[model samples]
Target: MSSSPAALSGGTVANPRSRVILASLIGTTIEFYDFYVYATAAVLVFPHLFFPPGNDATALLASFAVFGAAMVARPLGAIFFGHLGDKRGRKVTLVGALLTMGIATFLIGALPTYHQVGWLAPALLMLMRLAQGFALGGEWSGAALVATENAPAGKRAVYGTFPQLGAPLGFILANGLFLIIAAILPSDDPSRPSQAFLDWGWRIPFLFSIVMVAVGLWVRLNLVESTAFEKTVKAGKVHSLPLVSVFRTHTRQLVLGTFYMLATYVLFYLMTTFSLSYGRAAVNGALPGLGYDYTTFVLMMIIGVVFFGIFTMLSGPWADRWGRRGTLIGVTLAIIAFGLLWVPMLAGGTIGVMAWLILGFSLMGMTFGPMGALLPELFPANVRYTGSGISYNVSSILGAAVAPFIAIALWSWGGGSPFWVGLYLSAMAGLTLIALLMGTETRDVDIEA
Candidate 1:
């Protein structure tokens, strides 16, 4: 490989670019699967298995509160790992993050609940969740930047979408694993599963991360440091204080990127966690047979993940032509339209559920696909990692951290109307729209600092 700055800056798809994209996307997929499994468990099983049994509603909320605890720790993780990524290298930071996330997830599988260990259970559980949060804070932005920077100049948007697809892929695999478990367990209530499910089935999925971690470690270790980072280092131009430099130079970009992602995260948690519970409650109140079971819900998400993946794959080519700003703006507007239809689908039967799943997931694909390239584009090359990571994670905390709680509250307050959740999603999406209109476009900008 050429060592010249020009050679590094003139990236192309014909070389090892595909390999780099694959490495980032697969590693991120594995990491996110490990992360989202905990969120799913929090909503579905952790309250009963781990927490003290008091009021059912309060216990569930407490379980989700623990989920939010990790989001709170993400910003600190971003700063810590962002420093390493900028100064050291993307590969090294990712190596450490993968191990940390894997260990934390593995421990969650082995944990003893309140029945066995008393207060120590929730305490230990929270500690592990925070560790997971911290690791993931660094994982995504690093992966996205690696993929985008490695792509052939003309195909950056498309290559960028590869890493973004990891989100939907992770969701698909996580939910698919849970769906398999649900199907295999003797048909009773999901909350009160057959003895086999409670005895050991739940642990299987969490423990499965060990295999994925091993594979991710193998692939990532074999990969080279990103050419862009190496060029910056050779130029002696790497920011000594990336976090400070990022804020000072790119505050507006940071703010806009944060808003851009806010609604995406919010709607994501709502679709996966709160909707399941709300749908169940609605069925219980109305027609018992009309409610979607755990298996059905997971299956719907799988379908949505497929569409999300497809649309994300399509985003790159589109961005190269229409530009990242226009693509993102179009997607953002579509999301609001999707939100308007969310309630009718929830209140309706099987047809309605299918309609919402297809529409929402498709819209998710459109926004998320362009976001990988767009967010990193906001900052100059020197502090790209830190600025993008901080914006993404902070927005995650604001939009996603409390999404389930907010959606549930809305659903309950609105007397089971999914409309309120839609309204909440719209408001969050509206913020992104305003930010988009106000922010600068970077699609045609050069990557070199």
Candidate 2:
């Protein structure tokens, strides 16, 4: 195992491994916290608060469209931040991304609703959402590089999963906060004139991002740069234009990585964002839904996310032993099978919903775990940030950015049936399976190469 420089220099920390993992994990947790909070609000609060209160379907679609605007901005964020991350150091670019995301999220919490500011409310929300996307574009790849580059040899997959843990942890924290807020300001009845949750409860989660950002910045600012990046700089191998070099030399990796991540991105949004909308919609209405009360569904999602976190950790060691490609292939097959069974699972009511979510999240963890290592390993040290960030964020556009919007459209087109959504997911998983088959096993590769 290679012994890289510890995250804390000068001082002798007994466990440098813990420091690096925690630094990466905490920063990603903050990023996902800001990102997922907006996702939750897009489904729960934005439709009602930002859009004109008429035509439930149209309003929800508009809210989701606004939600997707950030996704559209992610690649641009990737290009900008990726260039900076490759040119400067990973640690500095990460700090900048954190600050950008934090300020945007906090401002979102303070924005006026449609009732107070009319069309201006959504307009401002759109801008904040774009900022969030830009920041997040750089966050994941940088965090992954930090963890994988610092990992002891043969343990890169395990260490890389540390950043992946943030996804489920962030999901839990984001929804858990919303769950508490919903409980505190209990809605008497949805039919009632007063809706406490829509009025003020939703803002609490977005407002709380300021606290998370502060702590993340503290942890990240104290960390040293990755040893791999330091070596590249010392060797004078740093590319003057990483984006150009990445395209010129590693275009295939970029294309392969993007498609390789398609299923993971699709599954993530479908389980977290799309399901929230599906669970809370009116069952007997023109657009049939599961008829679950808002709080009940949120609690269910929190429970499911717990399983996602556990399996995410478990997938790390499994990938290490089984090989990254093998683990991904098995998990992708499971995802395809799960998609095929979506109709029956979702139709089974509360028990079905629980089963559906738990199974979906478990698969999400398995597939998502090794990605932190897998994506970064696809590129050499010099352009790792630019290549991986652009690939991952571009995949977000093709997958997550359009997932909820696509799922909702499919559902509406299918007259509320989940079959089309299932087929869509299956198709995505199929693409990932092909990519995995074509790609090499990156578990044993040297990230600094």
Candidate 3:
């Protein structure tokens, strides 16, 4: 109940290291669970439920546009919450972000379909997606600060990675839940015996966020504030306007960090969202698709996501040993190679599809793992939250916000060839490689300095 920052910062946790790590991991997992469930639904259900009758391709594009709206909102969320996290404390901002994201996700589930509410349906969907993005803008940077700031000397990369694990774990849970519901619910085809999945089955996954949000809040409420932020408060060094300080003092770090993340965000949406849409459409129809069945593609994705989780864990220790910059550079090169192989590998049928997912995700893990520590380490403690959050979210706008839409457009431009998409990804990786080379090594830096 104290208004003093020091009192609030030190309110909980006797063992800050491990408890903070666990708390960060739990909060991020839940946040991303809410985030990713919408992503899956955008591809699987939103086109039918929210968009008016039109070309399936145009309908699908409309759904993805709504999905991208969240990414556009993310930077604004970052600016707002980042200031609070820097001035107040990481714990306070994180809790507020979780509540915002949870409420938005729950409302998204309860929204009426186009048939029921007409244009109001898509409009409401866009608003909710914007809310989700805004909340997520603060979530990742806060989690990274929590884990990295409390980490043992020389182990920040490994500790930071604990929060990064949430992405894969959230992906697995979101997809697994959808997979279960998809199995239980009837196919989209009315000709099938039971109810169509698009009609109501997809809502189950979105509504399920209510339970996960409760669990995340329980764990996060017990977390003590990050030690680095606590030290800043005790020293009376907290910025009154942290966003101004971030832009004034850390502009170069912000730019480099944002570009460093370009490849990871682009590849993520490409693998999960674009691939889902690509695989499920009819190959011989007016729109070109791979002609894969829905259930089979989801199952394959679940298997691939499991590997994403595994390598996400492994990437921590790997980055600790290999150096974050070195690990990212090596992995970015591999992503470039993988980008070139996308058409050939995917063209190989089911086995090839599996290979593509495994290879892409494995590389993604290696690169994404170090980002938690890397971005936070880029700036001093005074501006860590704001700098990292803005960098990460801005990259989302450039990379993920338009990735699927771009991929779809490129595919259409290429006459169904994936070459252009592959080229796009490879180009992003090239930019990331340049960013890595321009940045300094931070694994040995003092976080509180």
Candidate 4:
């Protein structure tokens, strides 16, 4: 008795394993590269270039406000793109999201600064930032589905990691480029970017998106739709309104999936955005920091993110073996521990900070990796795109969108101690742990069913 429903649906050639992996991986790499490029600049360049000259804290806060605003646009984009992905197909949706992000990023590169265009500078920047967020809202879930839907029996989690791998790769590439540019345009002072870097060098990464997006579009356009979605189409299971269908049928999973991803998002922004701010802020300022120069701190982040990539790849097999829920449970516990311990680590000076970074990023990877399969597994094929995108992006609003802003507030509250920030991370991880405890093991779930 043949039990391969995908095969029984019709005689269709399976998506080439390499193609599925590469398409999903490359698309997200480009998406995240665009995002992190903006993120790095929000910290390094935007405060000076976009906002009018003023109090440093107010300027930095304004920059972060624009940065967080993008997270608000994410769920909206998810709704639009999810509708398209579920109704049309993942391949076209992926290409559309990539184009959206690429164009926004490239345009941001060309935009005039506050000095050049006054209020229009920040307005244009916020508009492009929203577009980037919207594009990403649809990008991740589609890519995750591509990997998991194309996966062979018992290997969905492993295949799912392909998209997750993009986060670290994109972070490295984005920050690495900034570091190189900072080096090329050396500053008169050791602690800050050179005047040239401030003026024009930062735009290079944003402008470079055009080239990367071209490559992503090429790979994604070549992809055949995943068999699971193909089967959904043939069976006429595609919902006219996938968002309505998901909310009506999969409401419980939607809630669980959102909280389940909470800690991961919190840790991610804390480790990247908040850390860079904390690490480089002057030691004697109103909000005291470690006083490391900007270049040194970014270099440290690149080192930690290397571990993030390694563990992200490792999480696939681990989740495949132990199941997504179980693997995440363990990782979540570790995140809680790391959150509590990071205070001392930050105080331990450079080596301690590095240890804190490695530990934090490792936990980030382990927690972040499994969700590529875990979230999609929460719903059946017909609603997978919509359900996953909604859960993922809504959680972005709750977690990622507010994390940096909240962390900054907490940091200031504690007199730049970072104690409150670490505690805040622990608390979010606690919520995620509870959600994991409530979730079912999805490793063996028939996603196509």
TM-score of each candidate?
0.94, 0.95, 0.95, 0.97
lDDT of each: 0.81, 0.88, 0.86, 0.92
Tens digit of per-residue lDDT, candidate 1, span 1-449:
33222323455212265567667888789887987798778867788888888767777788888888889888888889889998998888888888888989998999998899999999999999999999989988888888877777777788888878888888888878877887788657754556677667888889999899998888777667776786788789898899989888888889989998987788778766776676555355531223666676667777877887888888788988999888888888888887887766765777778778777878778888888888888877778889889998999899889898887677768766778789889888999899888987788877656
Residues 1-449 of candidate 2: C-alpha lDDT, one tens digit per residue: 22344434645322267678888999899889888899988877887789999787898899889888898888888888888888898889989989999999999999999999899999999999999998889889989988998888888889989999999999889988887887788777742213877777788898999999999998888777777787788889999999999999999999999988999999999999999888887888677889888878888988899899989899999988998899999999999999999999998978998999999999999999989888999999999999999999999999999999999999999998989999999999999999989988887777877
Q: Which prediction has the highest TM-score against the true structure?
A: 4
Candidate 1 or 2, higher TM-score?
A: 2
Which residues of candidate 3, in runs, are more than 4 Å off?
1-15, 188-195
Which 10 consecutive residues of model 3 have the lowest summed lDDT? 1-10
Candidate 1 to truth, TM: 0.94
What value does the lDDT take at residue 448 in candidate 1? 58
> Candidate 2, residue 88: CA error in Å?
1.0
Backbone clashes in model 1, listed as residue pairs: 12-152, 157-316, 158-316
> Mind giving the per-residue lDDT tens digits that candidate 3 earns over 278-377?
7776787555778777778877887887777778778888878878898898889999899999889988988988999888888878888899899999
lDDT of 4 by residue, 54-104 (tens): 778898999999999999999999999999999999989999999999999
lDDT of 2: 0.88
Model 1, C-alpha of 63: deviation from truth (Å): 1.2
Model 3 accuracy (lDDT, Cα): 0.86
Q: Any runs in candidate 4 off by more than 4 Å, and if so which? A: 1-9
